[model samples]
Target: MSTDTALQVHSLKQSVDALSEKVDRNHSDLLAAVGKKKKNKDEGDENEERGNWGSKIDFFLSCLGYAVGLGNVWRFPYLCYRNGGGAFFIPYTIMLGLVGIPIFFLELSLGQFTSSGPATCWKFAQLFRGIGLGMVIVSSLVAVYYNMIIGWAFYYLFASFTSKLPWSECGDWSSAYCLDRLPLMENCTMRNWTATVNGTCLNGNGTLMALYNETLSKETMGIKRKLPSEEYLNNVVLGSGFSDGIGDLGPVRWQLVLCLLLAWIFVAATLSKGVKSSGKVVYVTATFPYIVLIILLIRGVLLDGYQKGIEFYITPNLDRLYDARVWKDAAVQIFFSLSASWGGLIALSSYNKFHNDAFRDALLVSLGNCLTSLFAGFVIFSYLGFLSTDLNMPIEDVAEKGPTLTFVVYPFAVTKMPISPLWAILFFIMLVTLGVDSEFVLVETVTTSIMDMFPQTRKYKTFTVVTCCAVFFLLGLTLTTNGGLYMLDLMDTYAGGWNVLVISVCECIAISLVYGVRRFLNDIECMIGRKVCGFIPWVIIKYWWAACWVFITPFAVTCVMVFSWYDYTRLDGYPLWADALGWLMTFVVILGIFIPAIIYLCITPGTCGQKLRILTNPLVEWGPALVKHRRLVARYVPNYVVDPWGKEDQNGIAPSDIAVEMQKQDAPGYTPSPEYYAQKM
Candidate 1:
């Protein structure tokens, strides 16, 4: 051969070798990828196979923290007050025992059994995971707006430092030194008082004369009775201040924005590390609100006339209890206050490790939440009583609505006391912290569900979650505008109010009926390694609980609708079209939970069965068999093999195949061991 031909041949050979090597690497990488996928599948199966276990004490605390939030503090007391004062507890306790506790246990058990978040847990019960998805979405929306409120609280907390008195600022423009009137007063003073180009005294009065002045005498401010007039009360105070004023648009706006940023930062810091970090963080976050509650209660009760507030709270008007509305309100309050059926609990419980005892945790957390709410009521009512006495008005007159109660009445109360600013700052700070912790959990639930459903995005889950939260915060800016309070009322009543109660009832029925109470009881037993001995589960599942849930849930919902319709029709000046839209929105929000559940039930009947099998079959098959054969089986079979015999196949057969064959032979998997099957057949 020619030398050139030989060199060309060598070059061709080298090229072929390089190409072949590249193919080999690519094949290896592909195999590795496939292996990783299989490994993930196997791990997922293992996760599914594991029984629901209760968490460590710390983890349980975190889960409880997520459940106990701003609702317990800000909303529940008002609910109790409105629904027959102390008389409300009668229905409240009934609802708690029949609905709240049962639902709490049910949701926790479902989550633990499935080892899935709300989105997927519904799938386990053969309910539309979309119901779970809708819940997750609604919760996300609520969390967004909820955080905006937290931002407001934080802003107020910050503002308390700068203001002479945070809560008691009057909207009086005539006060020369007050921050609110400074701009208008400045222009008026400058225009009227400045010497003109005409060289005459611009005003016969000097610059000081142009400035508006208030007659600051004891009569002007001293001991004004029966609370401030509605015209003087801002939405923040129930006085008729400008809705979308400089407070919302100017410095207050900046403060609110800063609060949003801080909220984001705190949530990110708490949840970025996932459940381990979140669990630890909640120990402080969940409990701090209570500390504030304790402090407020101590201070409040100690104040003179505090007993009047307590009386206002606890004095049962027996007449009110006779009203169906009162009972209805109490039921609604219990549902809302406990945060049941909100999907937050489902999502939080999903993070619990297998074997985490959620049963005890659920009971503890619910009780703790109730105690806090009760104590908070005492704290708030005591202060209100003081205000009533100070103003020499009826408690009803001095008492205000929700936001007003916090911002106006509470502040007014503090102002009456010495060192008002200090107390105001503390109170708002407590509010901020309480709201922040709850809001964080709400957002985190959304984040977790999203991450769980889209595992491929795990690498960037945190970024995606944070971005979603940022967008939500930005959207919430609408609420910070003048019409924000109206919007808040609309969302709360329509979205959070009626929808929450209805969703919870459906959730309980879905679990109890579709999944079956026995399965759930089994799941509880497995988690705690003890039987749940009683007629309680039977009573809840079969008759009383479901009946109560069915009756009360719809009634509560109708009340919301009726109230909304009446308000819009009578008060809001909304058009017929607006009413239609409002009803449509209400339907959509409530249906958000139900439609998904119906679809899920229709599509996946075996979902719950499969999960129960995973959780219970392992123990049912081997636990008793192992104990029976402990002495006899050891000589022939190793403990590891015997312990998980039903879980593992002795031969190379698949476990599913073995399960199938065992079923065919009408024997449990463990009963037909290799030795016994060989002998019998």
Candidate 2:
């Protein structure tokens, strides 16, 4: 308890601190020296380690192509009509604000800032690495059945080139129930056909006279006939005429096998060189569908009964807004349609130049996706209207989703058009284009994540792509069997389901709580600039940051997940084993989330709290990908705890001028000069 003893202890502590500082300084200097030497040695041989889009336009088009996919056409229109017509947009746009644009921007910013794919991008918070794995799992499963859909589109496209569309008339593939044209039974005597000795109409339906006349005293719903188009799809396309269920899968259909092979071939061809090839390919694949959609819309509007279809599509039923299911549908549609959390957005945006303005790209692609979905509603419903009048069915009856809408409803509608074959060709072509881009982009997402994790694999890009495509094609052959339609439906129902919702929720938690929202914003600011250009852009960027902090996106996605589970329906007619299998698939994909976290925690050397803190913190390497931008980050945001430059303040105090410096950047369209960073550094 002596003053001399206290003074001695303080002096010894100061000496220890000085020694630690000296050691740290020497370690940093040694690293800098080694880095400089390596740089000098590799200056001539170093190529750009990662690829970029040929231009900003290539990036935009690739995003556009992937965002505006087949779902916009087949799924959106039906959802709109089903969820109270135009009234659906209220929830749709709301969901877009809460979930779509925010997540879209988040993924793009994550990839662009890190210059990495989904898997390796998690270097920001290693504990959440499973998010990237889960994303890849969803993308991989989706790619398999999604390519099958593309194959079906290809099958229909080739069939459309015939002098007469195959589905336009009953053929050998037609079952006993196929009706080429509905017999007019208005006069109680069916037109164009007579009751035969077998007590059936010549057109393959039970005699209307027998049903209508005999059932005069009873309530009769008529013969319940099937369309020739339906028969063609079931018998010829799916070859499922006798398929009882998934357990009844018959021999693989060689024709569809050829079509699927062709689909994979096209994907491999486009992705052979990664973004370089896909970027150029998007110029065609991305824009072609719009032309067809516009043409079809125009043609559709001019058709009879178009008003009823358009009315059914846009006629807002404000009451449906009160339904939770409608809101759930809107949220699910927006999430899937924009391809959020699917890893495609992350993969596509990861190819940008370091300083590329992902902010503008995010807005452009998000708004474009929404408008495309709305515009597609007009195109699809207009045809549904015309088909409604032609078949004497209600607009609701003709409207459908999934393969039913794409193959049966649309094909039958086209058959009723002038230049039926041409319309058929254009329609199928649009489906192919819409589907192909999404299919390959998902494949790219999977490939990008792999190559990023193992940089050495990047050199064998073509070989990697071929192997990926070949593997997917082989797996997809299961869906080419007689009962594949049932299997595809099962996969579609379970593959993504609640799994992606879990990832989205995890992403929000990781970014906001684990990684720290303010720090993430600073990192983003390092790439896109602290001051946004215009008033609206400024407001948007601010709103996005607020949304991230407020947990709006995760909360919204969580609610949707709850509603989805509440509304979950067993895959009809599939046995209990099939349902169990679907759940197993979901569990396996979800395991992608927890397994990595556990493995990461186990390997981290520390007590529980220390290990968690370390796992949550970004690696020193996490920041802008380029050297200059990283230097700017170190100079401007030097208070970040894990600065790679070793310039972090020991006292943990950020510069008081940080706010004033940002204010100085507030000038309209202000751009930093190289000298600004140079002087600061």
TM-score of every prediction relative to native: 0.68, 0.83
Model 2 lDDT-worst window of ten? 653-662
Clashes of each: 18, 1
Model 1 misplaced regions, further than 4 Å: 1-55, 125-127, 166-240, 243-252, 531-581, 594-681
Looking at model 1, which ten-residue stretch has the lowest summed lDDT? Answer: 619-628
Top candidate on TM-score is 2
- lDDT value, candidate 1, whole model: 0.60
- Per-residue lDDT over 1-681 for candidate 1, one digit per residue giving the tens place of the 0 to 100 score: 999999999997876676556556545654555456546644443343221222365556665666666676567777777777888888777767766676777677667655667776654343444567667766766776777677767766665685366335445422332323222132333554653322222245442222232222213433122222222234342112445422233223444566677887788777675665666766677677777778888888888899988887897766777777666666666666666767777777765655556667777777777777787888888898888787555787566656767766786788777777788788887887677666766786777777767876557756866677777777776666545655565556555655565566566555555555554454455555442222234334434434543455444545653664454432164445545654665577667766754554455436776654443222322211222232232343334234444443445333442222233443323342434433433
lDDT of each: 0.60, 0.82
**Residue 290: error of model 2 in Å?**
0.7
Candidate 2 ranges beyond 4 A from true positions:
1-47, 181-184, 187-223, 531-540, 639-681
